[model samples]
Target chain A: MYPANKYYVKGFVMSSYSERLNEYISMVNNELDRLLPEQRIPQQVVIDAMRYSLLSGGKRIRAVLVLEFCRMCGGDVAAALPIACAVEMLHCYSLIHDDLPCMDDDDLRRGRPSCHIAFGEANALLAGDGLLTLAFETILSSRNLAPEQIVKAAGVLSKAAGYQGMVGGQTVDLQNEGKPISGETLEYIHALKTGALIRAAVQMGCITAKADEGLCSGADEYAEKIGLSFQIIDDILDIVGFAQEMGKPVGSDRNNDKTTFATLYGVDKARQIVKTLNDEAKALLKRFPKANEFIYEFTDSLTSRTC
Target chain B: MYPANKYYVKGFVMSSYSERLNEYISMVNNELDRLLPEQRIPQQVVIDAMRYSLLSGGKRIRAVLVLEFCRMCGGDVAAALPIACAVEMLHCYSLIHDDLPCMDDDDLRRGRPSCHIAFGEANALLAGDGLLTLAFETILSSRNLAPEQIVKAAGVLSKAAGYQGMVGGQTVDLQNEGKPISGETLEYIHALKTGALIRAAVQMGCITAKADEGLCSGADEYAEKIGLSFQIIDDILDIVGFAQEMGKPVGSDRNNDKTTFATLYGVDKARQIVKTLNDEAKALLKRFPKANEFIYEFTDSLTSRTC
Candidate 1:
């Protein structure tokens, strides 16, 4: 029923998506590298550890979401770049801490040694702390946003990073480890852990663009749906995708006894669920009929990926 | 020659000092209790862990520094209370993490079991992360400071907390564990690990007050000298003071093979160094001739404390 090989279109069209995504990702990597201090006494290793994971290949999807959402809402992409960068920094920190020996104990991240493995456990812990603090510093230092906007954006970011959001989700996840996971429990974890920051990314863009409350709320709702959908799809791909395709070991989750949407609902059912979420997200865009091409293309590309 | 009964007199004066410090401590404790979220999760132990150390209580010297510096610079102490509270929050986080199993691995903090001991290791780690993030949130949410002030304060705080500062110092300390002491190395650790945040606390006060550059610079210099002096005295006290007087175990530095001012300079030399630093810090107050009673009293009190 799906459009087979839609993403297989040759050179020119595929290059457009690849080029745009790569360009933005490059900008983010450059900005992050530039912002972090190069020479600090006695512990350059900590910074290097942070940069290792931060610069190690990711799609930079969160940043792309920020940039596209801002542009769609008639905001300047340049103005949203700091928030975009900050989102990724926060995400990288979560990954670093989650991979620690006392946490998930994963030695590999993005197909290489995790922060703790590279820099030792203490440094890894500090690197996570450093990155998380730097994320706030990045947002606070944004000259593009108004002071009020900065404060509001900071509030959004902190709430997403803190107890009511990602950390709380991790706590719950850790508690539920090796336990029988219910569908509701899975939704709660994904909603807070992954969805909170995604929602914040869109909201930050809208706030920076000075969009109206209604527009911001609509974008937030859209982000929330797509965020969960993205994670569900990721879970499915982890099961079905090969190690080479996913760039990491498969069935790792099964070994970890982690419950995922694919485990709970089966592959076909999960795919249908993502379709429903994608449709709902697109429905929210009706308010912004003049939305930029980036938003439409990015949102469309979400579930279209094979891995 | 030193006064024959000076130690006794100092002890008597310290009792009064303790009472006053306790009053401020109670105020901060109340503010902190109100600020932290009540435990709703099954992890009441996590909240208990955070509260145990938070309420176990120290001198609250950092918060006092923030408050007194603001007061000395002509800002309302009440207005600066949130950031004052924040400094303590950040300090508490550092202490908790420092005592973690993989870190300092201490069982006692302020005469009670460390957070990790009271609440599992994972919970202690989370508590530290929560407190650190909460510190930034508190400063960002400060209603009294202007947006510029908030941003600037956040920058100062982040720099103090980042790789160039506390985290860097911590990484070095960890790497140097069970290693020999060096004067220069100890100096570097003290400056970043403790001195950075203390300097930031004073700077934060000046920023909030919108104090002039000369006044701010003067206060910063004073804070820097006193911060180092405080650490030196702490090292000295660790050697000389009783466990009950000091609140935590003494000889922790020696036991850990950590180089400290006392170990490097000996008791008499360390004492002399603190005196010199205290005098230098006091001399900076000449620039602020109209400084408040609290500033004079606070600086004077730092040198005379038994713990």
Candidate 2:
């Protein structure tokens, strides 16, 4: 499934990065399934809609980041797995809400119909609400983590997903859509809209691992850079990448008349920024002695990926 | 505002139930304002939308339940106040989503335009999401509560608000709309949709108070009965209550073609049931020696209120 890993694994003494990441992704998927299995109740439709969007295959980058960061911080990955899944759930909920007709209004996600298209708008809305609620439930219910850690992690997650974070970012994005916006405004949108959650994933991992302030800040800095680059790559891909690989149709930003890094800075400059951010992100990771070769390769891959 | 309470305040030795309840309501409103003040940022629109719906005055029944139950269980009201605000936030979030054009399609809430009507659909949707996320954040960020208790209370909240609880009930209610449904189905819907959170409010208060299981169970039983009666009263209100007092159009259930206890059982039977349930609910409160006369009056008031 991840055959490209063979070429990237040359310098790594441990198992290939793809293998480990795949294992974490699989763990997340299985845990999600177990946590939100289908039921035969009358309200099963909402659960089905939630699972449909939640289980749809994406890169699972957030989950991988969570587990990898925890592992890098010398934390128990097993205990961190639930937090990883929680971040993914939060991500999916945001995606579902963002695709609604009143928002981005995208009809497709992950190469399939968006949640509202697949499920009616009402159920899709409820599904998103359910997923968001379930994310907190997942964190609070997690075992092997201390109560203080769970509370801290859940608080971090809620703040990242709330008005001060992703929702705020989305609001500003919506307000600025179809209008010319400055590069600073674009960065602000991306920072809260995408960067906050990505940073939260790293922070939650560190919290679960009981990492010190120094280590946590370092991971957060690394995450912030990568988060920006990830969005920049997403912007670039929307303009130039293949629809099949990306799953959703390309040129969506243009269609929505929304500004992006590629649009605001031009594709050439955006590409350069991605490289710079990726390098800076990877450099920050070097501060963690325990962070293995896989983390570096993973960071590098984000800037170069076509999809 | 609560002149009627003067007539009912004769038997209470401490402050009148209305005064106590009003004080709790005021405390909740203040805390919510403090926690989610209007911000002057690009994302301020979303915050405004959130504050719009959140600050809209309702009966504050859930907040009162949290504070009153905590007080009855010998918990510090100040410590429990945050949880009270959290429940109200959760309730408001649900109300916002439920009133969306996609869901209940309500244009009016609390005598004014619904969140979606005032803010555009997109911002309203985000406001609902924001509030829901903030609810958990409020609970997790609550000071003075033990970590274990906070986790337990938050877990209870997330479950009540998630797919298996309020969302599930909403889904089923939506599915059954315009379709003939039995009394059993209505009971199930009311239980999850309204009963779950009401029960959670009581349970959260008990958990915060470190109330024993016996007390929790007794309180839960009281809550469950009132919850059902509360819904039954809502159904009745939709049929016969004054729009000016109810703060929304009457006969919406009939307009939406929704089946309710008032429709399923004739108004007289429904009225009788409310009385029975209210009495039973008040009877359960007798097990709590620490519970004050305010609780008993509060229980009886739900069945008799016009709004």
Candidates 1 onward: DockQ, in order: 0.52, 0.87
Candidate 2's C-alpha runs over 4 A off are A1-12, B1-12
Give candidates' CA RMSD values in order: 7.2, 4.5
* DockQ agreement of candidate 2 with the native complex: 0.87
When only the first chain is scored, the TM-scores of the models are: 0.91, 0.95
Across all models, the iRMS values in order are 1.5, 0.6
My TM-score estimates for the predictions, one after another, are 0.91, 0.96
Quantify all predictions' global Cα lDDT against the true fold: 0.80, 0.88
Q: Indicate the residue-level lDDT of A141 in model 1.
A: 84
Scored by TM-score, the top model is: 2
Q: Give the Cα error of residue A144 in candidate 1, in Å.
A: 2.3
Q: How far in Å is the alpha carbon of A104 misplaced in model 2?
A: 0.7
